[model samples]
Target: MIIPDWLSDLHFAFSHRGDGQMSFKHADKDVVLESRNRFFHDKGLNLDSVVTGELAHGAEVALVTEADAGRGARDRNWIEGIDGLVTDKPGILLMTTHADCAPLVIYDKAHKILGQAHAGWRGLASGLIESLVGRLKSLNGTGPSELHAWIGPTIRACCYEVDRDVADRFPDHCRFLAGESIRLDLTMFVHRELWRLGLNPDYVTDSNVCTSCNPEFSSYRRDGLNTQAMACITGIPE
Candidate 1:
């Protein structure tokens, strides 16, 4: 588990190797998840408390509750078409799957509200960050200043070559010409969005790990169909 240092108030982790394939969607056929079960069991986190969505790669942010816990644990209890989740429930672990896509970990310590989002280029274009912020705002009015977002490791512009069609969706500043090919800086783009929405620029941290270049992390764009996903999760209680 790769833990971010700044998020001191919450129990959060962006899992890499040794954590296993968290999702059954891309689990290995021959390999069982008993070790994976033991992993969470050691942390005293019930897999049943983990909440996930169907993940449509869009901007649908869902409000999770204590009742919504375990919806997507070991079964197909995910909310449909949602790419973001915000919860005020303490024990409920909010999670999102990623393989080169940005795994956004959000926490408003003052209000004790936590959120997780899966933002790829499509999700960014659809304004998933803004939607997540908006949802948290409505959740007892926790504003941007109180929220601290950590943009977890993913493919960066150095290896994320894109075409014009994909590049056009982003701001001109977020795109750069790379010898006839365009590269999109997702971390920069995400920072711009969060800052634009009034989040303190200092609080928005990005882990500049490029999944495409780094062998330690998984990248679907680089590893193709056989790749596994990384899970980023955060909760209020210990």
Candidate 2:
């Protein structure tokens, strides 16, 4: 697991491969719940206080409240059709699952707002980051400059080879060409998007850990259909 030091005051963490799978979709429901509960408990948190996204790989972002907690903790009843979740309430954790896809953790410290977004290739293409920032702005009056963000571990450009169709969606600068293969730097794309939205580049931190290369992370590209997932959590203390 990674606990970033960039923003010390907020409660944030990205689970690693050894942390066990948190997604119940492909694993046993009871086992997934047990692992999730243990993980939260170890961090002095409770599964019941976490609001998870449905991870539809879309651009939708939702503002959750304390009442929405535990919506996806033990069952599949996640916040439907949303890939991003944000909350300003204390003690309410926001979580999103990821494998090769990057997990984004955003915090508006000034407003005490926390958010997590699942940014897969499709989600990025659909402008998930923009949707998330827009939600924070509209609901909490939090601008991009007021936010600090962390791009969690993901399949970086070194291992993110894509087809011509996927490469065409992004700019040339975000693509890396090696021999005949085209690789996309999702981390860079996210950073540029955040900058375009008026967020200060200094406030954005990338873990720089590639899931595909690191044995400690679950990578869909590496493990294929049998891949599990890691959980990303962010919140305020009670």
Cα lDDT listed for each candidate: 0.81, 0.86
lDDT agreement of model 1 with the native = 0.81
lDDT by residue for model 1 (53-159), tens:
98898999999998988877666668989999999888898877778999888788787888889999999999999999999888856568878888888899999
Task: State the lDDT of candidate 2 residue by residue for 81-161, as single tens digits.
Answer: 999998888988888988988988888878777778999889999999999988887756656797889888899999999
TM-score of model 1 vs. true structure? 0.92
TM-score of 2: 0.95
Worst 10-residue lDDT window for candidate 2 reads 1-10
Model 1, residue 132: what's the lDDT? 93
Q: Judge candidate 2 at residue 185 and give its lDDT.
A: 91
lDDT, model 1, position 210 = 84
